[model samples]
Target chain A: MMDLVYTPDQEAFRAEVRAWLAAHVPKVPLASFDTAEGFAAHREWERTLASGNWGMVTWPESYGGRGCDLIQWLIFEEEYYRAGAPARVNQNGVFLLGPTLMEYGSEAQKARFLPAMASGEEIWAQGWSEPNAGSDMAAIRCQAIRDGDDYVINGQKIWSTRAVYADWVFGLFRTDPASERHHGLSKILVPLSAQGVTVRPIPQLNGLPGFAEIFFDDVRVSVDNRLGDEGAGWQIAMATAGFERGLMLRSPARFQQASRRLVSLYRQHHGDLMDPAVEDDVLRCYMDAEAYALSTYQTASRLLQGGSIGPEASCNKIFWSELDLRIHDTAMRILGARAEVEPSGSSDQEDLGTWLDGFLFAQSGPIYAGTNEIQRNIIAERVLGMPRR
Target chain B: MNFTYSAEQIEFRDVLHALLQAEVGAERIRARWDTASGRDAALEAQLRDFGLYSLMFPESLDGLGLSVIDCALLAEVCGRAALPEPAVETMMVASPLLVDVLDRGLGNGSVQAVIEGVMSGDARVAVSHAINPHVNFVEDAHWVIAGVADAIYLLPRDKVEVTPLKSVDPSRRIAKIDFDPEEQYRLAEGEAAAAVLRSTLNRGALSVAAQLVGLSEVLVEQSVRYASDREQFGRAIGVNQAIKHHLADVAVQIEYARPVIARAAYTLSVSPERADIAVSHAKLAAARVGLLAARHGIQVHGAMGYTWECNVHIWSKRIWALVREWGDEGFHKNRLQQWLLQSNALLGPEFTFGRRSLLPDSRVSDPVSADTAA
Candidate 1:
């Protein structure tokens, strides 16, 4: 019937979530999650969310989730961002790895890791993308040799987001020494405090170690930590990447919230900005945000009806990343000199500092999550069915 | 609630897609553009026989009684072929408007007969909207539903003046309209007239947006197909990152725009009061994406695209004309800004899907809620 409205129970759930967030969300914004103190503070917030079973709404209740549908998850997000909740410090664990675990992990694996991940007790970082394998993830060189029911890993992973402060990392490691490319890859989880592991922070332009570099030297992990079939790491990692790019990692609510703030910013400066071009750009932010949200709803509904997200995730990735750029860029135009100021942390609408920080971070959107160039290639060959020259 | 189209809607869109591809050739669409007669009588009769004109006729009028949701997707298929018959305007806007006027007891015996004729494929209606400042397809219309000075009326084509104007899109036979005002045919006045006008405008805007989206789809799809077949530098042109990336960007715009258009159509049908911004957003997204596809579609096609030899312009040209019709970009932008800039306006993620989701204090007992509770 193409009904786009929420149901009564869905609305009821939203009410519960809104009231909870309103009551508990920090009155003052927490520091950026990139810093050690901020990382700890945000984790505390995650604990608060977990206390109310709002950690991961769609995950089963046994795993500390409320056992809600995707619709409720979207509503929770809408309210989360609307209420100005702190940024999630465990995005890699909850958004990407958690969903993958649900799909491919053993029951025992779920019981051991899901609760901690939900409660923010153990934050996880991704260990994909070695020094040599940025967009070409299949070219990973890290190896984890299986020995007596234990895998000893030795290699380096760069661009390991949150590795500087995280408790663990789950990444792709080559298991078969003789095999090449994607064939020998195995998905394994390793503790950061394990022996022979060194973490080096890579300061971004913001002078924060938002991501890190990990050097693995004889780090030992039980073979029981492996997910799915041994040779199927490429497949499993790809499924996770699909989740990252398509649905979970970058929900449209985030951008919708940003655009709403952008509209307020634009309206605040409407008298000085009569330039039709600037006006059009502001309108585009709103339109793009709405368009993204609607597309997600369409996707969510289709998924609920048993359709899996596929290469269309490539389109979604490109849309949101570019949209993020447009939104922050437009905010910069509206902010003028205010855009360059450090965080005043006054309010979200007037938060020129966050916009400035976002402007810098949004540049990584096209580069990370499989560079926009590679995404366009995927869309061409896979989604649009064009030939590879 | 679900957002995907129902099975019946999909079937209708697919059937129209096949029929338009087979029957409405490029030459037929170009018929009105050339010195040949502006109307395709035979094709018009065939579309009427297909019951295209009666799609929105109320069931009491012995019709399928469909809304914009069932037909707008098919409009996208029609846009792919650049259908020149004004079927979207007649079926979506005019038919619904007629049903509204009649249901309000404003229509006389002749208007009833016209609606009956529409249901029987014996009549086609053209709308002379006040927002448009002109009439379209008057050469082929059996009647005109004209809005003027906060009043509505029914007028015959002969009684109204339709001065044909050359349009950027050759297929759109636009004209300045002048009709005699008669009290006998007045449908409604004041707020009732405004209500009817508002409904027609949203539906018409949605129709145009659907067509624009349709054109955008064909442009991207055809460009991809062309780039795949055409070779350059010893390989398929689509092999180059430049070409693939351009087409991919257009595809992204189209992907996101479809849902916006769908939501607009749904809002218009289920919640008309809330449809203004939805339709505006839909048109804005559609026009922007449509233009992107047009520019990039031609760029990928090379010199052949620039020439008359390529049919890309057929889709591209209509995008230019239709984008300006039924409220252009500036009009929609202004509308959105008006609502957003209001001092009390609530702009955030909570307001995106309307305030229904955020208003938890207000409760309603419905079957779906009961099921979820159980």
Candidate 2:
């Protein structure tokens, strides 16, 4: 029977997750991961979650996960966000690369990377966008020449999230010098502390070095680090991008929590913010959040029935990114003049800084994980079968 | 929680689609647009034969005894074809109201006769809820289920004065129905009437929302087909980025609107307490997206979209007509606002479908009564 109600076992699983999260989630929010201390704190939080086998619940039991299905993963996320747990610092590994590795990684690669990744011992950063290849990712000029027993890579990867403190980074590099566009690239895993590697922190709009630029000066790694075939980087990166844009990353629970906060804010200030227009905007944010959640549940249900995620990932990406921005924008609007003034006291500073930080971060959503424009083109050409220019 | 439709639901939709494809077409809708009655009796009989009218009625009453979700699926297909019938108002709204009236022993012989006549395809019912300003398709209806304040009345078409009103959609025959309280047959009054009226409006909104979703799909499909075939500047217009992006935006809107409608239908059937939020969410999204699809469909069709010959206008007009049918955006927004501001209801991802009990500081004592409040 096709049912929306959770099964008995799934309900029990949700109860277990809720109980664990309630007891363990930090009372005070952790600092931004841009600083070394804050990054280490997030890493410690990830390790604590892993100790309870809650690091990556969807991975197989052998990989330190419970081997739960997507539905259970969604339930876990709902509980996690509801409990106000610290953000997943190892998201790049657990959300983006972890699923791709499961799909395309060789047995040796899986055995070597999955356990450490599940345990948050080896945090990962994405190395996709470069100074020249932000939207046109296939135009990457980074090259990794084949050596006797290793591939010597020489490239500069910019906008690499968590590269300043992450242990390893996975990215696409040109393998076949003679090929062009999307054909000659290869996905390779490289350690940030490898010889000939230098990382420079780049401050974001919020004055945080949450992302960095990685320069590879003739870095050499064994052929075992290459995933799949030598010149199949585009396809592999796309699979990873699908996971990043699809169900795993940006779970609906995150926005739901934001919407709930927005509602709470509205309720607290209803006497002052009594305009029907403001009320309508607040309701819209709540509606869009609920709509996105329902849509994602439908997608999760479909995927659990052995269905594959298609260009709908582009659709999901566009919907949620815009939704996040709209919700934050409404929050700022609700704050009104208070939005303009910086907090004067310690408690007020922390309380007000959360919304300010959120507003700044939401701006990056459309730019990262493939720009919304690029996503629209993909939807137009690939999903809708429109003629490509 | 599962969100996909069951195999049976999919099969039911497929059957209705096949029937609509075979019987209802643009040409049929266009033909009916010029007629005085603005209805295709044969098509209505065919749909009735398919058990669409009996979908939400009790099985003991010789009906199919299906839920609102099943009725919503059929209504969507009807909207897709622009079937020019009151399937949504009759099957989804009026039939269930009739059943509730009968179940409560509030129905009289007149109401029973009308229900039998509607179930047997011999009569049609037009509902006039307090929320809707005018009664729709009353000229073609034999019975009018009119709501006045806290009571409901079963008024025969002859007993009421229906002042014909022109609608943007030519196929829709709407009117302001005025009946004397003494002359009409009272079906239910007081709290029971209020409950029935609320249920009627929610189902009405859900049906219209589903129809708007279907119409949105039709607009997108029609525009895509036109763009693919109509060439300009030495190539198909769809190849251009401007046209492609416009259609793509419409597609995205339709993509999100669909699940909202489905979820609303589910909430109506399973969680009546949360029906206001779910239905308003569905109606708001569907109306917004449906209007977007209509505007883009016309823009993509260029000058032809405004003409009577182009099939896009038929569905486009229906979109405009249905946007304000059950409840306008402002009305539903107010309903949601009350829930958010007054009820202190839990608002989060886990509570999307009304898991209020799960909240840590949940105010269980003051459960949201927005449905009744609205």
The candidate scoring highest on DockQ is 1
Stretches of model 1 off by over 4 angstroms after superposition: A243-245, A273-276, A344-350, B31-35, B357-374
Clash count of each predicted structure: 0, 1
Candidate 2 total steric clashes = 1
Tens digits of per-residue lDDT, candidate 2, B114-184, equal 87888888888889999999888897688888888889999888888989999988888889989887534
Kindly report which residue pairs in candidate 1 clash with one another: none
> What TM-score would you report for chain A in candidate 1?
0.97
> Local error of candidate 1 at A139, Å?
1.3
lDDT of 2 at B120: 89
Candidate 1 residue-wise lDDT at A349: 42
Candidates' RMSD to native: 4.1, 2.2
Q: State the lDDT at B347 in candidate 2.
A: 68
Where is the poorest 10-residue window by lDDT in model 1 chain A?
A342-351
